[model samples]
Target: MKALCRDCFWTGDEQPRRCPSCGSMRVVRHEELGVLGIAHLDCDAFYASVEKRDRPELRDVPLIVGGGVRGVVTTCCYIARMSGVRSAMPMFRARKLCPQATILKPDFQKYRTESRRIFDKVRDLTPLVQGLSLDEAWMDLSGTERLHGAPPAVTLARLQADIEADVGITVSIGLAPNKFLAKIASDLDKPRGFSVIGAAEATAFLATRPVGILPGVGPVMVQSLEKSGYRTVGDIARADLRDLADRFGQHGLHLHRLANGQDSRSVNPNEARKTISAETTFNEDLNRAEDLEDQLWPLCEKVARQLRAEGIAGRVAHLKLRRPDFQIVTRRRTLPVPTQTAKTLFAVARELLAAEPKGQPYRLIGAGLSDFVDGQEAGADFFAEGERRALKGEKAVDILRAKFGKGAVVTGRALKKE
Candidate 1:
């Protein structure tokens, strides 16, 4: 299939303005479309889109999802973007740019629920799915044409349509010969876009793009490359490989390969994350340890819930505090046995928090668990009977919360006021 209409799923070689079957102009045509399998699927303005989906009244209005005035924006709708509001911009600045925009605080639980539904649909198409975040993922649909009775492109098109129908959100898809080009192609057209990059055009397409477009090339590295007269991918493509290797070591070699549109990395489903944490930026700065501890309880519960959901346990419990001046202080403690229960996580994190200098006002508090192992590998008997009973009670609370809602049972510490 050299051409497919995204709306009707019609296949042919003819390039037309609209699909003959459905009369929709959403057509995707490519020379290597039928053969290439690697794809990147990115939900458009994920958090904002979910908000718009739930509250259709805000569909046309500009929306920004973020924290308080002192916090940064997590994401914004296209309407807000047209007014120069961007992710990571301070909420105060975003409000200034889009004065009429509606600002909503992030509801991560809702977002995660929607993300899980979307991912389930994706997994139905292919098992080789690598999730990058709640909004984006890389899918390897290689060697599945016979099973699906269609090429990867057609399956991907159908998947996009299915997600929109089932999840009430739009997605952009990129199909290419490799992971690198696929990711880049996905961003070429946005909101509800389908883009393709063939092996024959990868090098030429990458050469004209800025070096910053390459993955892992951050602002600091861009500045360094610009100082060396390397601004575009083509500049690196034309540079001496030996000189680049000598200057930047292995990283330079890696960049050189990517500059030439060569990426050998596979879409591994077993890619492990480095850390899992939950943090909250308070609307008002908290000074007293009691107030901080009250806030800390919920965050600890969140991290524990995530660990249980992922079937992982951690050997280290971490505490993080951001002072009113934005300076951050971090503390960590290693446990003799790994755990996925909030009781242990909170106990360790509370100890770490107590060790910090008291009376210093903090604007943010975070809890994290790291140095992971499979949940089954965690030694539960490390705690005495009473402690174990408390842990079991927490697990029971988790079940009730899942069956009912998050408010099914509230811990005394969480409800305690400073």
Candidate 2:
């Protein structure tokens, strides 16, 4: 067994109640701590933590980041969690649970700024960083012992220390042989936690946990699994794979593999970004397409800004509309060539919007781009040389916006009032 003190970075041959050097009980022990390199780093109550850090008055108070009365909770601090406040719960319910909780609307701009700073720190640790989202990432720290002069465990402790000292935020890290287990362990102890699950005890460890603990196993699937007597990962692990496949179709095979810790998926560096999208729920649904288009233009610019920032492009443009009744309608069109241009995305999306029935009110409307490739490889049309020139002009406009400001270049289409 190997043990390390998170406080002092002391290594020992065996687990101890407290670190010999620092006399701290915040010790982490693992059989493969030095060897395993796959890590999942998740920030602790990310949005709420940021809010508390900036507003000292909110430190001891329960905090919730969301919208008005009709909106859902985006996130809540640990203090609010004690009162059963949870993410995605309706704001009405959350307010009822913890009436004292200070509701704050999401500051996306601030969050993105802080997230980039955190991301830079993670990349400094290893280049094999795969960002799962703005708040979490997977890191592969293998084959770098000589460069760092310490194992991944010690290096991770140092990272935890740096984050708290410099950023005034905390993160929980999980170390395991694979992404699945690492992701699971990251949640075991949160708010500055470092937990590990070694290969030897992986199966036994999973057997005791509920199948709902598995990624992608939602509430509906959990109910179906319970009806089939597959309440725990133990049940899934013991069941015949062919039987599971026969019952649940393709998903069954995945469940079987994950149960036994048989995930072979590599930490892909070029993880093709699947989607770039954003949506907002209005205080009240709007019926007029003009008002929606007023909102849509900014969203298209946002998506385009993100795409250009990442130096990526998309061949498919998609439009999503959610009615007040919760019915979601989506439409997509594949372009003749990939693009990262706001103009291209907005044109196709506007066409899609025109095709939809306009009389019905919508609570939410979103647009996105997918089927990605390098932006540099896009904009070349085989038949239309003029279109290519137009795209080149668009690229130049994007560069100008990047150098100057977003308002520096606004398309004529966006200026037209619907």
Candidate 3:
């Protein structure tokens, strides 16, 4: 087998404890290292890392990026992770766990700027890079060996180092033949890691893992799978096709394929986002429709801002409610035309909210826009004159908010106390 050093990017035939060229202990050896190219790159502790990068004094301190007494954590540094502070954990619990940790409100605009820089670097290597989020992406580097004068592994190692050097943060890389395995491999190691999973060993590798490891298998699905005698991936991998199909329909077939280490989806750089939305968990559940509407307005504004940022418009407006018991209720409406304005999003979602059964307290409220089209399409001949007015008015406010501050403009409904 051959080995490579992540630090020095030195390759040698004999597997050793350290790199002979650089004498570094960060050595990785695999029989199928060079050929595998489909890769997933995840920035380590993205928001917290960016925060620490900007504030050198906090480099060694535990840092968390989130706010609000009731809001869930957005992200936390590895040091905070040691103290049981995790993303999406309640802010109160996080404070109890890491009392000394420095918590900061999220700076999304700054983070997005940094994200573009990082992604641009990846595009330098391969235009096939598909961003899953601001902090993570999938890349296809197949057939680029001659261009870079090295295999995908070596090029990726160099890219990883380049990212850390240029961006001032570390990232982990997972190299595999397909998307499913690649995603799993990325999380095997933390902070700065490089893991590889080959097609040859994928089946045996996934067999022992729990069914919950597979995508789309939530807590409820896990229970259903357990009851169906499918506790592990191996069970599903070996299950009779007809039996699985009879029991689970298409979902069973999907589980069987993924369990056996198969993912046919290709890397798509132009993959259109299906939705742009935001939601907040309330400090306390409220049963009143008026209170929910107050919460819904901010989320509509948020989604509209996101849609505008992405230069897209959605023809579908959606509303979501989660009860105290975790039961979810969703409502959606098709618009006369696509829109990317807070007023339109709010109007559609507010109407949907009014139609839902009354007297139901919801612990969470979310709204989003989907069924997208380019922003240019929003001005089409078929576009309603009212929607055009709403978009124009919202754009003017967006400009004002950008120049002045987020508080530059506020709705009458926005003043309603939570």
Candidate 4:
């Protein structure tokens, strides 16, 4: 067993009620403390935490970070979460559940800046940082003990403390022998926590848990598994791998391995991005194709901005629409060649949108680009001459927008209409 004082960073043996040196009670003790290397780090209510940090008035209060009444909650503070508020819950419903909570708009740019700063701090601890998203990642701190003069667990705890002190945010970490188990452990504690699950207790601990606890098992798959009489990890663990494979095909093999707490997936730091996209839900459902195009244009611009920032281009454009009745329809079209301009993206997306029978109102719209390649291959001759001209115009506009502001350069039609 090992015990460490969080405040003073003191590592010692006895698990005293208080740290012997600093006299602080925020002490953490664990059996596998020093040996574990892989870790999963997730920020504590990230969007909401940033809001609380910048606006101290909302610190102790229940807070939600989202959009208009029509939009959904991007995230909420723990206090709001206690009232059944959750991420992706509609803002209207979240407000009714916690009527007194403060509601704030999401400032994505500010959040991105802070996320990078926090990531840099984590990289200082280890280079095997596999970012899962802006607020979560898997990090392998193997072979770091010689450099840090401490075990991976202690280094991780100190990293969390450093973020809280310097970045004004707290994170929860999960430590285990591999990526999957480490990710599961991280969620066992939250807000500001460090939890561990070692190889010794892994199988036994996972046995009684529901099959839904596995990473890829969603509600639909859980229902299917339950109907087949396999309700828990123990059931799958006991079942024959061949039998599972016969039932679920390739996925059954995956299930059998995970049931025994075996994960072959590694922490990949250089995972390629498959797609980049953004979507927005309307305050009132939109029916007209023109109205949908209005929403689609901005999303395409956003995707183009990301493409430029990443220095990549994509061959295919994707468009998504959700009807008022919750039926989702998606369409994708590959260009004659790849292009990154917002003009080309919108042209392709506009064609797809025109083909959809659009009398029914749409609650959501999204645009994305995929099938990536180098952005240098994206300019003239690859697309229609009209599109080529628009690309040049958009590039000039992009520069002007960067010099001034996005509002300074807007499409003539869009400005007069909106």
lDDT of 3 by residue, 182-272 (tens): 9999999987999988998999999999999999899999999999999999999999999999999999999999999999999999898
- Per-residue lDDT tens digits for candidate 2, residues 100-121, read 9999999987998989899899
lDDT of 4 by residue, 1-418 (tens): 4777778888887778788899988777776777889999999999999989999989899999998887889999999999999999988899999999999888988998999999999998877889988999999998899999988878988899889999999999999888888998989878798888888788898999999998889999999898988999989888888888888988988888888878878778887667888898898999987788888888888898878777888888999988877778999998887777888898889999899885978989989999998877776454467766766787788899999998988875466448
Model 1: how large is the Cα RMSD against the reference? 2.7
The per-prediction tally of clashing pairs is 0, 0, 0, 0
Q: What is candidate 1's local distance difference test score? A: 0.88
TM-score of 3: 0.93
Q: Tens digit of lDDT per residue, candidate 1, span 1-418?
A: 6789998899887777789899988889888888999999999999999999999999999999998887889999999999999998878799899999998989988999999999998898888999999899999999999999999999999999999998999999999988999999999999899999998888788887889998889999999998998999999988898989888898998999988888999998788766789888888899888888888888888888888888888888899999888788999989878888788888888898888887888988999999998887555655545546655787788899999998899888876842
Stretches off by above 4 angstroms in model 1 are 14-23, 323-334, 350-361, 380-390, 403-405
Candidate numbers, best lDDT first, in rank order: 3, 1, 2, 4
Candidate 4: lDDT of 383? 42
Model 3 lDDT, residue 204, Cα: 97
Q: Which stretches of candidate 3 lie over 4 Å from their true place?
A: 379-383, 415-418
Looking at candidate 4, the ten consecutive residues that score lowest on lDDT are: 379-388
- For each candidate, the alpha-carbon lDDT, in order, equals 0.88, 0.87, 0.90, 0.87
Best by lDDT: 3
Clash pairs for candidate 1: none
